[model samples]
Target: MNRLYHVALSPFCRKVRLTLAEKKIEVELVEERYWDPSPDFLRRNPAGKVPVLRMDSRLMAESQAICEYLDETLPNPALIPADPEARYEVRRLCFWFDDKFNAEVTRPIMNERVWKKIRKEGYPDSRAVKSGLAAVKFHLDYMGWLLDQRRWLAGDVMTLADFAAAAHLSCLDYISDVDWNRSANVRDWYAKIKSRPAFRSLLADQLPGLPPSPQYALLDF
Candidate 1:
């Protein structure tokens, strides 16, 4: 059987998981402590990233590459658009969330609020959390603007871009960091995506000492 080495709350891992689930690929989820990487884990991915997928006798390292490969191999429910321009937009938005949003918001907030507690590294940093909270509002407004004009972030059809964005927001929402009421458009968009069958596993995830927020698993929320 195919297997995935990942951390439950990592947005990058979640993106790959979402893509796999969307395409109906069954993978054994193995929670790896990448911070304390073993030789076997490092051999799987020299980069020592959390999302290392072992599939079809191949070890896939990067999240985007793995997800896109799955989309290309399983074309039934295509996640990336066929048109070059549309494809570029999807990749651009995917990077927007994975890199920009992750750097400005997800990393900061999660590092302080979730990772610290999980790793037992240190206490939560209020300033960093506050900064991330402030930054997320801007991102929510940006998403709202995008959704205002288009059916999805990249286009009319749901694509990997939506999964990328949702991956980050869902992590934050797990800890009650996202203020869904900030943007009606974004809120509605999330509601639609969150209700998908692929989202069930993520909604069910519980970080031992740090349980998800009350509304984290609520479909109506």
Candidate 2:
């Protein structure tokens, strides 16, 4: 059986999970404590990251690489466009969410609110939380602008870009950090994605000692 080493709330892990689910790949989920990296875990991924995937006589590290491999191997309901230009746009958006959005928002908030509690590594940083909260509004407005012009972030089709963006936002939503009402367009886009069969396992995730927000699992939310 395929298996994924992951932390329930990590956006990077969620991206891979979403991709796998979209392609209808069954995988055993194993929560890992990457901070206190074990030898076995390190052997799986020397980078000491969550979301090390073991499948088909192969071990994969890096979320994008794993997702792309899955996309190539399992082509049903393709997440990447065939057109070169369209594919470029999709990849660009994926990087924007995974790198820029993550650095500007996800990491700050998760490090403050969730990671601190899990690692027992001191208290939440109010300053970081405040900055993250402020930054998210800008992202939401930008998303709204994009959705107003396109059916999806990258194009008309729901691609890996949407999954990447939604993965980060969903983690924040679990912590009640996202303000859904900030943009109706963004909210509607998310609602559509959130209602997909691929999203069920994500909604079902329950991190020990960290209660999900009231609306985290609510489809109507």
TM-score of each: 0.99, 0.98
Question: Model 2, residue 119: displacement in angstroms?
Answer: 0.8
lDDT score at residue 164, model 1, on the 0-100 scale = 99
Report the C-alpha displacement of residue 38, candidate 2, in angstroms: 0.3
Instruction: Provide the overall lDDT of each model, using Cα atoms, as 2-decimal numbers.
Output: 0.94, 0.94
lDDT of 2: 0.94
After superposition, the stretches of candidate 2 with alpha carbons farther than 4 Å from their true spots are none
Candidate 2: TM-score? 0.98
Candidate 1: worst-modelled 10 consecutive residues by lDDT: 113-122
TM-score of 1: 0.99
lDDT per residue as tens, model 2, 23-63 = 88899999898888899999999888989999986889999
Q: lDDT by residue for model 1 over 90-179, one digit each (tens)?
A: 999999999999999999999998888878898988999999999998999999999999999999999999999999999999999999
Error of 2 at 203 (Å): 0.3
